[model samples]
Every structure is written in C-alpha cells, then in structure tokens.
Target: MKKIYVTLALSVALLLGSCGNKNNETSNDEAAIAVEVNQTTENQTNALLSVSGKIQSSNSADLSTRMMGYINKVYVNVGDQVKKGQMLVSVNSVDLMAQKAQVDAAIVQATVAFNNAEKDYKRFKNLFADNSASQKEMDDISANYEIAKAQLEAAKQKKNEVNAQLAYTNITAPFSGTITTKYIEVGDMANPGMPLISIEVQDDYEVMAMVPESEISQVEKGTPVDVLVKSINRTVKGKVQEVSTSAKNTGGQFLVKIALEKTDAPILSGMFTTVQFPITQKSDTQMVLVPVDAIIHDGQLSGIYTVSQSNTAILRWLRLGRIFGDQVEVLSGLKADEIYIVSADGKIYNGAKIKY
Candidate 1:
C-alpha cells in the first residue's frame, strides 16, 4: 500500500509540471509589440490656405485681323520672339492697291481744276475792283472757284479713307511677346476678327486660382503668397494682384490672380501649381497636423493607427484637410492629447499588442 501511494504522488506531480509549461508558452506569445508612438499636439502657425492653381502669362492675347482676304504670307512662326509693331502676317491686298491707285488719280485731277479756278477767281476779283466786270460775272467766277475747292477736298478725304482700309490688310504685333500659336498658313482665308496668332509675355508669369466663397473674404489684394510649381518642384514668391468681388461668372468661386516674382527657375505657362495664402489665425484657434506617411488609405477612407489604453493598435478614421508641405491637416477624429503610432516594426492590426 505504501509503494502504490508513492507512485500515485509522482504521477500527480508530473501532470502539474506539464500544465505549468503550457501556461508559460501562451504568456510568451502575448508579448508587447515594438512600435514608434507620437503624442498629438496643436501648433500656432500662420494658417495657410492651399489651392490648386495654374501658371500663365499676365499679358496674353490672340492676335486677329479685321479684313477678309486670302493670307499672302506669315512673317512670324510659332515660338518666335517679336517686337511691338512687327509685321506678323500679310493678306492679299491687290484689290486695296487698285483702289488706292484710283484715289490718287482722282486727287491729281481735282488739284489741277482747283489751281485753274483759283487763278480765274483772282482775275475776276481784280476786274470787279476796277469796275471792268459786271456783278453777275464776278459772282459766277467766285461760285466756280468754291465748287472746285470743295471737289478737291472731297477727293482728298476719299484717299484718306482708302488709306485707312489698306492698313487692315497688314497684321502687326500689338506688343512684344513670344508667339505661342499660329492659326493661319499661306493661302488660308482670313476673315474679320479671325485669330491669326497667340502671343504671351513669357518672362512675366502669374498664377490663376479659384477660392471658395467662404474663403474669398479672407484674401485681399497685395497680400504676399507662395506658389509651388509641382512640375519643377519649386516655390516662388508672389503677390496677390486681384481678388474678384463677385462670384457671378466663376461658378460660385472667386478668382484670384497672383503675380510671381522673378526667378531663375524654368516656369512655363500652363504649369500646375499650389498656391499658399498666409492667413492670420486667432489666438484661441490651433491646427492639428500629422505626417503624411503615417496616414493609411483604404479606398476613399483615410485613417491612422492609434495607441489604445491597453497598448494595442486602434485604427481611427480621420477627416483630413489640405496638405502643408510633408504634413497634412487633421480636421477631426484625432484628439490633440491622444497618442498615435507613427510606425511599427511588425504588422499592426486592431487589438494587436504594441509598446511605445
């Protein structure tokens, strides 16, 4: 009976040891995961309103002609630099030339008649003074002289009108600029008000941006701004030149023009940009911002991994706002005092153990 009792006690001790080892293995598997954490904070910064914009020349125009005729020759080509009053295009002006020739001939004939009438009027006036001519005779000569002078004046006016019309057959640059487009080629028919070329002053550039009605009131003319050219990855200084008072034609958004300062960066027209307007923030207001890389996206939803009270990851959806440089504005869903996981060494999911 004593031997059997010893064997039973040994078996019971072995079962207890096996149960203890299993519990230790389960505890090890639940170890805390390594992670990097950050405490959310608010910042007092000059609030910037960022909006998409496009770079363009402040002075741009589509050159057009006023006469209808076949194009004779195009003096300037696309990408050519031209000066003010430089001839850009010529239209077929053979008809205008013929009209001019007729006008000139009429003026010459009128001039000869005017000279003869003047000589006769002087002779008649002398004869009347000497009492050698009748009153009716002198009056007739005077009337003839006046009629001849009127005809001469009329002919000169007609020539002036023809000359003015001839100017329309030649197209000239209104201002010094670079030609961006050419619409007419040799032999193409040119009509009145038809655009022939497009020109722009490339050195002077500006940004055109639209601001929501809610924010337009905060923007004022002469305010300085920063324009970020996305294509060249450059930020240039600029000043707000205009702010529309009415949104009637801008699809409910106000248009704002920003004049960029001179820079060596290769900025071209139609380049995409982001304009930042610095606004003064009230003392009580603050903005919450987070690193862009820390935010995860799921289709249209955006969220960030946050640390829970139990040291686990909790994905919190976020309402994001405009981006500022490498960081993004967090409008809601995250508190200023809460802690978030910026990065982790292992995969993170809901309820996954983490350690700061």
Candidate 2:
C-alpha cells in the first residue's frame, strides 16, 4: 500500500509530538515569584474600639460558707498567699462546740440570779429610806429587782448569740488575697452559699469588657484604655473604671470596667484581654489594615496572597476583623488600594507569576 501510508504518517507525527511536550510542561506563564508587596492600609487613626476582655482581680471574692458543715479544714491551697485575718476554712466546730456548751450553762445560771437580785435591790433601797420598806413593800421589791436584772441581760445576750455562731465555724481571709479557687475539699460538704474559696486581689488588675448597646454610647467614665494581654504578649495601661448604665444583665452587652494602670506586667487573674476603645470615627470611615504577617491560615480558612492584574498569585479568602496591633482587620476580602503578598521569594501558587 505505500508502506501503509508511511506507517500512518509516523503515527500522526508521534501524536503531535507528545502533545507539544505536554504544552510546555503545564505552563500558566510560570517563572516569576519574587514577591513582597503590601498596599492595603486606610486606618485613619483615632477610632480604636477593640473589646473582648477578661483579666480580673480588682479584688475578687467567692469564698462562701455561712453555716453548713463538714469541710473541717481546707486552710488555703490554690496558690495560697493569704493574710488579712488569715485562716482559710475550717467548718466542723462540733456543732459550734455544742452550742458553746449550752451558752456556758446559761451563763452560770444567769450569774446566780444576778447576785440574788442585787441583794434584794439594796435591801429595798435601805428599807424604803427609813419607812422600813412599804410603798407596797418597795413596789414588790422593785419588781423582783427588775426581774433579776432582766434575767442577767438575757444570759449575756445568749453568750453573744453563741459567740456569733462561733464565727461561722471559722473561714477568715477577707482581703489580702491570692487563693484563686479551691471550692472545698477536706471531706467536702460545705453548703450555705457553697463557693468555699476563690480569692484574688494580688497586684490589682481589671478588665471585664462587654460593650454593645450599640457601642454603649461610646464608653465614657475616664476613658484611657489599651489592655491587650492575650496571654502575656502584654500591652497594659487602662482606665475606664465601670460604665454599665443598664443592659439588663449583660446579654445586651454593656458592662465596661477597665482599671489596670500600675502594672509590672505578670497580670494573672483569668488573663485573655483586648480592650483598646478610643472611639470617635465619622469622617468617611474606611478601615482596611492588613499585615498580621500576611495571614493565610487554612484550617479555619483565612487567606491573603492577592496581586492579580495578570501579575497572578490571587488567593484572597479573608473576612477577619479586630486585632489592630500588628495589624489585621480586613473584614471581607481586602480592599483599600489592594496588592497584598507581603513576603514570598519563591513558592506561591494560583497561576503563580508574582514579581514585586
């Protein structure tokens, strides 16, 4: 036949030269990636407002117990350090020492009937001043000397009400603190108001934060905030001491607090902060901000890359907000003048070709 048409034209020219070397090894205009771009800023300064807070201890408490027994002895433990009236917890005062031994046997039988009614009211006021006693016999011996001096002041006020219920079986420490939390343990039980131990006041910190009745009327009471203590990466300096004009109990937010100025940082109490707050922002309000090391997380999404006007590399994703220190608000895939990337020098993807 023509050698079978010259071997079917050499197998269609080696199948079109192996698809043109696989289209030049999958090219999407490859080689370029030398990135380091940036451009998205627009924060216009004075308009902070961060929020989310916690760091407590503007003198905390909890330490419950008003009379229910069993705990017998917990004596401080969770980080100890007590002091103001010390003695942390005791409880089993054997029924308040058997009711202080029945109020010391009714105060020794009312001090022997108040010394026999003050010797029969001073011998009936000296025999009724010489009438040898008789204005109805000195008014019936001055009414049995005022009923034995009111039963010896009612047995010394029932032994001062059993020594104030034996100081509630001892639990002490009302100030000078640092216990942090132990909620009863030496044989447990404790009930009247439960709690048992929590303490705090060690260096005085405070933050609280809630804000939102549409920005709690722009938070006022002394202003001056900053806080940001997200686990030791510190920031400190605060003021706005309390500002909750009602949010019916925090679900609608409101509850400010702040107060953390004198810090040698090492804050403690619950930690986890982020206050900021410098309000005032109306002049066209834009706010984009970006550099949290150029983001790009992945597990919970959050991306960045950008650049694409044919200079390629376009990941995008974003939707973040709040973290204005090392920069990071974006709230919707970037904008303020675009350009992103911030760092690269090689491996970047999506149509690749970068180059700034």
Candidate 3:
C-alpha cells in the first residue's frame, strides 16, 4: 500500500511539471513578436497639388488670308517684331488693280452722261412748258436722265467693291507680337483661310494645366501657384487666371490657366512646366500626418495598424486628405501622438502581441 501511494504521487508531479513547461514555452513565443512602430504627430505643412502643363503666350494667332492669291511679298521674317496695323504680307494685286481702273473709268463715263442728260432734260422741260417741244420729246429726255442717274449709282458701287478687293491684297498685323512661324514664301499660292504666319504676343505668358475633376474646386481664380520649368531649372510664381467650367474630352479634366509674373529668363512658348497649387482647408481642427506606406488599403477603404495601450496591434480605418510627398494627411481614424506600426512585415493582425 505504501509503494502504490508513492507511485501515484510521482506520476501527478511529473504531469504537473510538463504542463508548466508547455505554458512557459507558449509565453516565450508570444513575447517574441516585437514590431517596430512609430508615433504619429501633426505639423503645419503647406498642402501642394502638383500638375504638369505647358507654357504658352497669353495671346497667339495664326494669321491667314480670306482671298485666294499668289503671295507677292513676305515683309516679316521669323523672329521679327511687328506692331499693330503693320504690313506683314502682300498678295498679287495685278488683277485687282485692273478691276479698280475699269471701275474708275466707268465712274467718269457715267458722270459725263449724267451731266449731258441733266442739261437736255432741263432744256426739254422748258420747251414743253412754252408749248414749243412735243410731250413725247420731254418724256424721252426724262427717261434718259433717270437711266443716267441709275448708271452713276451702279458705277459708284462697283468702285467701292473694287476698292475693298484691293485692300484685301495687303495683310496687316492684328496685334503687336513676334512672328514665330512663316508657313509660306514669296510666290507661294496663298489659299483662302490657309495659315500664313504665326504670331505670339510678347511680354505675357501663361501656364496651362489640366486638373482632375476631383481637385477643380480647390483651385479657384486668383489663387497663388508655383510654376516650375524643368528644362530651364527655374521656378517662378504665378496666379490662377482662369478655370474651365466644363471638362476636357480626353480625360474629363478641367483646364486651369496660371498667369506667370514676368521674369527675366527667356521663357518661350510651348515649354513644358509643372504647376503647384496651394490649398488650405478652412477648418478649426488639426490633422495628423503619417508615412504613406503606413496606410493599408482594403478595397476602397484605407486603414492603419495602431498600437494599443496594451501593445496589441489594432486595425483602424482611416480617412485620408491631401498627400504631401511621402507623408499623408490623416483626416480621421488616427489621432496625434498615437503609436502606429510602421515597419511590420504585414503579418501582424488585430490582437497580435507586439514587443516594441
């Protein structure tokens, strides 16, 4: 009986010791999950929205003719400066000049006929009143006078039409600008509505950018902007001059114009540029900032792994705001001074033990 009790006691002791060892091993494994985390904070940063575009002149035009004729002379060359109303090109006017001469001769002939008819009508009217001329003779004189008056009026109209045609032979500058392109040379057939020369207004330029429809509201007219020319390695300040009320056909983006302040650098038209629009939300609340990679996406919702007071990872869905470089603005779900997992291998889940 004494041996039996001793054996039973030893067996119970061994079983209890094995259970204790297993518990300790499990605890060690649980404590080994240490994840590097970072504390999130808020900072006042100027929110910037970047968009790429091209620099263009404030006013540009492709000059063309309305009448088809051979180009007689191209007075301005590429890179030439011209003033408003300055003659830029000329068309062959030989036919127009001959037409003008014909109209002029017609005018003189009509005037002479009108004068002779007027004298005859007055003399016949006086003879008819004195009963010396027949009624038929007076009627014929009156008809001749009327025909002469109509002819004179037609001749004047022809002269005016010919003069207008003659004026079309000369092409004048519509505005003060620099000639950037010449599409035709002397003796080239200048077709109607065909572009002859391209001119751009000097001393004024604007940067045009296409903004996504989601960001169009934040960009308003007169808003300040920063323009960067990558090729020239230059940055200049500008303002939002205009915003399109409608969307573009390609990508449903709205066009935004930034009028650049004049700079000494030779910023030519059609230069590629990047524009930065500064936006500030009018809110009395503060926003938190975190690394871009710290945020995780689950379908359409964004979330982040936050470290709880017990050092357990807890997933919290986040509402994000404007993105600033590598940092993102946390509009909600994350608070300032909260600890969040920043370097986890994405294996950490909710309620998981974290050592750091």
> Once model 1 is optimally superposed onto the true structure by TM-score, how far is the C-alpha of residue 183 displaced, in angstroms?
1.6
Tens digits of per-residue lDDT for model 3 on 1-356? 99999999999999999999999989967665677888887776556777788999999999887778999999999999999999999999888889888989999999999999999999999999999999999999999999999999999999998888777789889899999999999999988889999999969999999887877898999998888888898998899999999984747889999999989977899899878888664466366888888888989999998887877889999998866545778988988888888876448788887777
User: What pairs collide in candidate 1?
Assistant: none
lDDT of 1 by residue, 128-183 (tens): 99999999999999999999999999999999988887788888888999999999
Q: How does candidate 3 score on lDDT?
A: 0.87
Model 3, residue 122: distance off in Å is: 5.3
RMSD of each: 5.1, 13.9, 9.0
In the range 163-232, model 2's lDDT, one tens digit per residue, is 7877877878888878878976888888788888888887877889887776678789998888889888
Residue 204 error, candidate 2, Å? 26
- Which candidate should be chosen as best, given TM-score against the real structure? 1
- Which stretches in model 1 have alpha-carbon errors above 4 Å? 1-44, 116-150, 283-356
Off by over 4 Å in 3: 1-46, 117-147, 248-251, 281-356
User: Would you list the C-alpha lDDT of every candidate in the order shown?
Assistant: 0.90, 0.82, 0.87
Ranking by lDDT: 1, 3, 2
Q: Write the number of the candidate with greater lDDT, choosing between 1 and 2.
A: 1
